[model samples]
Target chain A: MSLDTAEVRAERAERSGSRAYLSLFKALGRGWIRDRSQIFFTILLPLMFMVLLASVFGSGDTAASRIVAVGDVAVLDGADPDAFTVVEAFDLDEALAMMRDGDADAAVVQDGATVRIYPSATNSTSGAIAEGKLSALVDDVNVEVLSAAAPGEPVLETEVEEADGGALRPIQYLAPGILAWGVAISGVFGAAGTIVDWKRDKLLRRLRLTPASVRTFLGAKVSVNLVVAVGQTAVFLAVAALGFGLQLSAWTWFAVPLVLLGTLAFLAIGVVIGGIAQTSPAAAGLSNLVTMPMAFVSGAFYPLALSPEWVQAISYLSPMRYLNEALQSVVVYGEPPSAVLPQIGFLAAFAAIVALVSWKTFKFDEL
Target chain B: MDAAIEVADLRKTYRGRRTGEIRAVDGVSFRVERGEFFGILGPNGAGKTTTLEIVEGLRKPDSGTVRLLGRSPWPHSPELTGRLGVQLQASAFFEFLTAREQIETFAELYGATKSRAAEMLDLVGLAEHANVRCEKLSGGQQQRLSIACALVGDPELVFLDEPTAALDPQARRNLWDLMRSINAEGRTVVLTTHYMEEAEALCDRVAIMDAGKIRAVGTPAGFVRDLDAPTKVTVAAGQLSGERVRELAAGETVNADETAVVFETRDPRGLLTALASDGALEGLSVRTANLEDVFLHVTGREWRG
Candidate 1:
């Protein structure tokens, strides 16, 4: 074809704004999928953490204490079945033998109105709990006998109830926090490392010569990261719910927008590091330096309230903390969407501020 | 119509911790007409790539102005970028994309169709390697893919910076053909290369640059013709006696060594006629001045590249 006609054809074929964005999104997504190491770090690593933690601290169920009741004590009949398992022993020697053999946590001997509890030294925690429950049962029996013989009723009674209506298991808290941590990692490391690689490879220079603007390029990248974040959330929630019996509430849907915001905040930080770092390795190192410590202070593994006061104070500064809290509120605590409005606001502000900083620091060329 | 590129008094300086301030491009000015194949020939560190980058809008010059297709390149005008294609000195591709995928991405960025991208791959003779991962391609193949990406948009102007550098002889020759085809389409081509032979072979007009300055600018033949250098004639050393050689010299410079007798002369025909009559033309060879000689004459230094 003639040069003039070729130019005219190219001009006619020129695609506008969204085409570049979609093409870049597809390219980046395909690249990320093909990189096994990246997939391992971003998705599999967090899922691994979830599995390990869930197994270690299984679904908030306290193990039932085993108690050998010598000669079938009357008090044993009133014991809560969920809290204790009572075993009938013919004599005191049999009950002591059961405790010695590790078959029972403690043995109860009833001699007249006085009852003695023999707690196992090997199983100290369960032994102590069994001893306490047996002594309380003996006191209740004594109160019942005295009340029948003397006054109309006992002076007071105590009732037990959870402060929060539903049991908050450790796995429930960990699931959302781990998911948020994964999102942070993929967002920050993915953006920073890829940008540095592109710069080193001179792809940034090539892109500048094209008609697509920087905004279009970065928008495509951020969109890919967001999609990956959503995928991460799905995997984490499904594993937590199906494998560990983590309860989900209607408010859990709010995690989608929160994840997007959190990814944006992390990606903004990544952009700043990518702009500053000279190489991909350096960018990775810097991202880890920022994200690992942030994960700790943000309470991905535990509650922020359990940290030291100074650490808690610093936690307020970490965007990860806000993301974790927002996700936990909606996913684990079953709080309404409005309950996490402040956290969402904080995350949005962090993303905006960091994005502005990255924009100011960003450079298309090393020089 | 406006010239393809117009650069005036362009200057850029880089400050290094140890080197302090280095002038990368100093008071450089040149113009490339539409549909012209222009070459910037220089040695390493001569600022040819820097000048090309500034004109391509990849960098900001500290001072002076560049009018690319009648528009300022600075501040990154999208309209100007759409009409220009650039192949950088270094070839960089997206991480794991195939050759075709890489060019297709560039086509999308430039708003060209995938068919055009494929056409460009065919144009560069990479159609067979379309499915090959870019990292797996040979150095020459990678360079060709970069060129394909540059032209996928069918730009009116194209900039190539050392496109054939460090390639094998066959690859270099093949690339020369590709470059010729690019220019044959009537696209204004601006090329920077350190190889004098490359500049001589492909460029319509050549600008010789040294130490961040344009030493001279003209057609390759024009520069050599204007050099006013004498041709060298050489033959076996012992073919004739010293006395006879002096007689045949006729006031021209003559130097004799153990292997050959050399003559520097303005009139090669006269010298050849004399050698033929003397019957000392055995193993004789004549050498004409070329772009390398022009570079040495203009720069006052040996060609280091």
Candidate 2:
């Protein structure tokens, strides 16, 4: 009789597909968590970047230049109140004290016709901005004095108005971009690098010989990446709130879907790069080629509005731009979820389309 | 007598950069009987691995059929894979997982218990290093771990490609012993190697391949016995001069030097009788051709080269 009897055949066919998938997922997840280098790239490095970028760009009086005016400062005339916040000191000594103590970025002392402007050198950016606005105000006062002495006099005077809710610091605008940046870096490089490493090591080749299908393998990988992405977003948001006293809107809960969608979008892109690149080094280089430029143009570190109009137009092509806009709307503008529905829709569609493309192109086969 | 594997006229072609179309496995055919240790021996670029991959269902043959365990390997029938174990030439596992965990994970894929993983690891002599990461293991240890993974499912037929390629001599011998033990349990094994000695020592029957074709197929002793090469006799030059040895063998001398005198003869009996009568031929020895010589005579190239 044949050794392949009914009992033997039934025993062989009894392999559990779910257990196989769980095995792969558990193994990959353990590797991701245990490897110090992967953790550094996925979580620690991004968290470090958020802290560094937020501190540099989000903190301090990046909102508006603070000016302390003394005496009858005629030089302060016809200046845009939004340009600087001008405050009064009892005398030149108190104004100098305020400048010394960083309470004021600049001090203006008026001595009759001889008006003198003293700015703190330590706060050079703020001091320079205040100096420029005060110089224009002095010119306007001079024009008023000259015109009044001439025929048909038109007296022009300037009043200092404090900015509502104070100045907008660099950190205020940058907090959302930093969050988006964390998601992009971890999702793109993390996924692509891991896939390339698996290929280079021949791990995928080994797994192909088993009963596991490609769908099960990729499903496990995507599930792990999504979990890691969500965890990273939560940690960064909490740190941003605690460290910087960031005021996030109740609508900030929408960032969860935004983060997940953003992850899927970048993760799909990562799969495409990993599929095309033949080696780990090639994948790393290509990932940098994509993410480095996207970080700059997508307003991760700076506002796209500050860039040239053409560059701003190009930002529309970046998925990071949409994600950043959604996050900023929720965190900065405190806009309702309806305000970001378009961004959410675009990101979801982008993810679905790219994921489909990735599914078509991705393979365990060699390039 | 059932065939554990039956491959017929298998052909797989690949497009090469400068070589145009390269036939990796061209019309290769062989059968591995159940419960036998079958080996495929060849030098580098000899298509041994390609053919084995086709049999394992990892690669598709352009035009042919492969039946493993009485089921077609192509069309991705899991009946074969479920009962077949495979160890690729360079198998890699997750760098962070311990050897025990790696084996257990594979066992879980086969629906086997963790205890079975431990048993396999113990069988392969990796029990001591069970907690060690795969990346931290030595080359031989890693090879052993791969073998353990292959056996974790208690497979009926196993495929091992270059399992002992770069191992030390002792490790290779240990692996041979392990294979023998596995075969003793009525499991069939299919392995590929360029090591003629490994094939001679481990294989019950072997197919010698060259240029993507089987040059010869037989047992180790059968190949050597079938070769037309003659037996050789060598004596110390001080005992028997080359001239004297050649005179007795009558132009059957194949090689000689000042230090030794050598002669080739179809029948070593008469030559030895003559040499014994001479009595001066001390330190005399007779040698027969082996698989290496058979390879040279059959394929006209060194077995390794």
lDDT top scorer:
1
Q: Write the per-residue lDDT of candidate 1 for residues A1-367, one digit (tens) a residue.
A: 3455766656643557678888988888888788898889877899899888776656224767798888757677788898788889899888878777788999887777667788988767668877877787788887887888888664577887765546777787888888888999998998888788877678877887898887787788788888988888888898889988889888888889999999999999998998988887799899999999998898987778888998899999999998998888888778998999999899999999999998887775572
- Cand. 2 Cα-lDDT: 0.82
DockQ of 2: 0.56
Q: Per-residue lDDT of B261-288 in model 1, one digit per residue for the tens?
A: 9999999998899899889988899999
DockQ of each: 0.57, 0.56
Q: Which docking category, incorrect, acceptable, medium or high, applies to candidate 1?
A: medium
What 10-residue stretch in candidate 2 chain B is worst by lDDT? B73-82
Residue A234 in candidate 2, Cα distance off native in Å: 1.3
Candidate 2 lDDT, A74-185, residue by residue in tens: 6665556766778888899998888777788888888887778887887776777777767777887778668868968656667976562445556566778877877887
- Per-residue alpha-carbon lDDT of candidate 2 for residues B130-226, written as tens digits (9 for 90 to 100): 9999999998888889988988888999989999988899999999999889888999999899998889999999999998999899999899878
Q: Distance from true position, residue B16, model 1, in Å?
A: 3.3
Return the top candidate by DockQ.
Answer: 1
